[model samples]
Target chain A: MADANAETDLKQTPLHDLHVELGARMVPFAGYSMPVQYKAGIMAEHLHTRSKAGLFDVSHMGQAFLIGPDHETTARALEALTPSSFVELGLGRQRYSVLLNEEGGIIDDLMVTRPVSEEDDGKLMLVVNAARKDIDYAHFRDRLPENVSLQVVEDRALIAVQGPEAVAAVAAHAPKAAELAFMSAASMEFDGIDCHIARAGYTGEDGVEMSVPAGAAEAVARALLADDRVQPIGLGARDSLRLEAGLCLYGHDIDETTSPVEGAITFCMQKRRREEGGFPGDERIQAELKNGPGRVRVGLRLDGKAPAREGAEIALPDGPVIGTVTSGGFAPTVGAPIAMGYLPVEYAGTGTALELIVRGRRLPATVADMPFVPNRYYRKPKS
Target chain B: MTTYYSKDHEWISVEGDIATIGITSYAQEQLGDVVYVELPEAGRNLSQGDEAAVVESVKAASEVYAPIDGEVVEANGVLADEPAKVNADPEGGAWFLKMKVGNSGQLSDLMDQAAYKAYVETL
Candidate 1:
């Protein structure tokens, strides 16, 4: 039974009432009542996002901006916090990066985007994990130079529409967003309401994530829902889709102790950032970059139908526990159980035989390649 | 023959000394799409309220408790290959196991069809 205080303490998004009206099974997520699954269930919601389009209420995510006098100062200020090269991030483009603590451990993973509008030149927008929002804001408030400021956007809602048919479903209302290249963002009128839409998502699908005004969120969502090709997805499918795409979930796949190198996300750091060593944890990151991390995150494909979850022991095929599963579940797209975990570098190679100790049974598994399902981002044809 | 329900959401239908056990339809609905099921091995002795089988959905795993003391005689191996059957026909073809009752009198401790319905409504 849900505790009374816990239920009362749970926050609701702008679309909470809409979720209930649609017969959504609301569950507490990151201190908010988020939909884990709708009536169609996780399986159907997951499959629909792969074939058609799935609308997700991601408003629980933390949205904020780092403000400065110009783009350089703003980007440089952010570059000090994360390993990624933000200065070179062009207008309309977005880059994924992680916030590192003084020890170089990941504090949180976030997406940084430079808005396309010229009026927004001096500000870099950020979207962080909901659970870490307070930590992130406090960290920024304490660290950012006096010349720069951190402004949290509390009145906006993030709506993500992902899948193969996502673009068509959303483009019917916001035509300019359809023109965006993957990793690009644009300010456009979505259903006649001003929204910041980006052609990027966690699901590894061709889709858009729109930052809409909180009050207009439902109207915009209802407009997109009118499309026959779209379905409202719950957080349950959101997790499975990202797992199949080989994406990491903060506090699970990574934490304050895990470095970006060990987390298998080195690409977020550009060559300049890697060589300059200006970011937090650069000393350890540079060392790991040269010598390789002692342990690395790898994908695991279990043999049987039984799904092994987070904290399951990962063992060598013939003996001994070596690591623990970080994120795992039944991948609806792959039609099999898939998982990701940290393993000793020696045993992290693809095709390496492994075993997952679940329910006291050592189930056979293999060190498989990631993105159990392929990423289908909509990239522009090169000129 | 009589069907009895446990508060843990498992149902056991007793016929003579043999009893068939499975999760209730309400339990299956709460579990969502079942991906896997692990049943007790034949000859495994279970006391009332002991975990007798495991039912796994895409979200997580749940233990189905033995409503009454029994010795597992046979498990429905078909569930291993097609676990979704539990969601499709939870009360019928998807019965978890067949057991020889250890104490038929313990069956009296379980809820009857109508009483079980009322108990579920309270939840």
Candidate 2:
């Protein structure tokens, strides 16, 4: 979330003081004073997490719970707003879904987790982008059934421990957490505070996300960082990690103007949801599902080393502008330049050669399969 | 040999007729990861302060300007596969290119080590 107001008057996270004490380079991001990098710098931080573990303070995200008497009523109300099949989601499991507008464009991408039991009054939890939280809450408040209560959890801080050794790093602090499978979350005790631990992350690695109380966040982060395998990574490394994982940043890759189909995220809509068609933007989304979108998001491999940044115009063989790059940079893992952009469906296939016009020079590029680096998401055995 | 720096943080080490150029360590740190380096082609003539190469990181892309009027004598091919070397050794092994000095007088327009240090402080 990018708050124009807070951009000038930056807010501070629970770890802000810690980051400053550690000599981190703080920059304004998503309405907070965030560390862009540390003394090791971005390159080392990028590779460090790929090889070891990195702890990220993502407290800027919004955490909230939806309570209803039963899961059916709560999930149905949420399904009315998002595109995912939340009702059928098993207990302790989570799904990546999008909140859509009436026209089918995304409001934001969020994670919805089912409650651990039917007795729990709060049956659903939502983690949303920080910048859009206020508006998102207002939308929910107006649309949701009175039976389902939306309670914003303001006293919590979110931290992500990501990489191959993340599980071990975090498990050291909360040993019981070692058994939690990917996308499954549970309320547990850590450092004498109740915390919600989810086996999920943005880096496409085996990791766990902890929603700790504000007071315990710093202690949890410090404990994790105390491990030789874990280091505190900043937003700079976080951006590169997600980019390489082929995940989209909220404002850059998917916004209100881009539909789910156009963003190449139609897989988010379950078959049941597709047939039950009561959701917003159903007509446009279902139509695109059948006929394909006019423009689709795809990855690009620049012919040369020159990076084609966001807003760079993409052209076809005849040099007509077809689309613009949404996100582009050098992929440290790939050893070359990589980009993600929307293009006409005809130009969205793997190996569809194209050109990027930057500064009057047309550099050759080609559509490539995404997750520029292969994803490593952990999934439990299917029973 | 004498070294000179541009405000944009590029540094050039000049000998008799050839000059070796690279980005300052501060520049690399600001850029984060140096993932790709687009070096100028050998024999490409460049004027002082002209954009001669491109340097990209995981988060940003920057243009490396020619330190002085010169013709590219050699480009760093090693960077194509090992661009991280720039982060590892910004001054010595990560030099972007070597060029034949075309107008040595342009060197006077750049800052020396002491001046460059003070310039960085102001930033």
Candidate 3:
């Protein structure tokens, strides 16, 4: 990646120097100077993360803590905004939820974690997208209960270590981290500093997310990357990695105009939230749940070598435009062109034939199931 | 045989009135992990600097230009399925097209290997 230092003055992450030392091609991403890939390149990094482990410096994301009087008070305050059962959430567990507008469109997707101990009552942690964090925090501040306090933890940096070998790689450095299951989080010690370690990730792989103090972030990232299995990945690989795993990016796949139900993210809303009907756009979501959404997100496998990219028109048998691709790429592991887009419910089934209009040529395509690469979540054992 | 390159990083191997075309190593390095290639059909006449092919990577799409006026005699069908070959051997097996040159004088306008390397360094 070419560096355009003259173009925009962007903020640098704690691992900025480390990335440069590792021969990373730095690029401007979400207002941060981040690595898009190392000398090994994006494809190699994408595949390496699939087979081994990849470390990502996502400290650009915003972190905060919401405190009230008790768990019931905190859960009620959070549930008023997001469509998740924060009350039923076990201590130390995290939930994937969305911030929605009044009309039900997604504002942003965020992670909410409840600390393991009752000692930290009415306190919940939130991690939001870097680009939308300011607006998200302001929105929360305006809507949260008067008794609830919102504190932005700017002194922390978030690091994600993802892939099959992630657990082993991280456990090697922090032994107690091995006991944390998927979506569970706890305050822990690393490199002589107290930090929050969560069993979560975006790549659909088994991984851990460490929220370390800003000053210690560089040391923590270095210690993780010092392992043979861990390599620093950039945004180029990050986009492709998430696409291959069928994860929806906030601005691209699910945006202000797209609802969680239509985006196939209704799973984020628990049954209690669905029936209680209190979160924003509850009517639209309930209607969608009962009758199904008008259009739905689905994956596509192009028939030929042509990659059907975002904004490419998807046409029907008669050559009429039916939908548009939101995310498309050549999956490094799949070894072919894969894409995800929104199509009418009638045309969302697997094997449904379609065509992608690419530069005036009609390339044949078909609907496929999501998570083109199967997810390997480390959930607790079913009772 | 002599090799010359265009500013867009396409290289042409010239021998008599025939030229073989492929992207330079610098071009491939910038594109990263080529997933698909859209080469012009054989028998299609092209002008100098025409947009003759499309190369897609996981991150973005790029256009490959024709370095000289010519008629395509052959297009690399191998790249249709194995585009990574471009990354593995950009100068060797991953050549995009072969053309019958219509104007020999166009070769003087292109850069040689040394000139191309220096030009790339400025980028």
Candidate number achieving the greatest TM-score relative to the actual structure? 1
Clash pairs detected, candidate 1: none
Best by lDDT: 1
The lDDT, on a scale of 0 to 1, for candidate 1 is 0.94
- Model 3, A153-214: lDDT tens per residue? 88888899999999889888777788898899988787567888999999989999999988
Look at candidate 3 and give me any clashing residue pairs: none
Tell me the deviation in Å of residue A381 in model 2.
Answer: 4.2
Order of models, best lDDT first: 1, 3, 2
TM-scores of the models, in the order given: 0.99, 0.89, 0.95
Clashes found in each candidate (C-alpha, N, C closer than 3 A): 0, 1, 0
TM-score evaluated only on chain B, model 3: 0.97
Measured against the native two-chain assembly using Cα atoms, what DockQ does each of the candidate structures obtain, in the order listed? Answer: 0.75, 0.45, 0.62
Error of 2 at A276 (Å): 1.6
lDDT of 1 by residue, B1-123 (tens): 889998898889989999999989999999999999999999999998898999989899999988888899999999999999999999999999999999988988889999999998987
Superposed on the true interface residues, model 2 gives a C-alpha RMSD in angstroms of 5.0
Fraction of native contacts under 8 Å reproduced by each candidate: 0.71, 0.79, 0.75
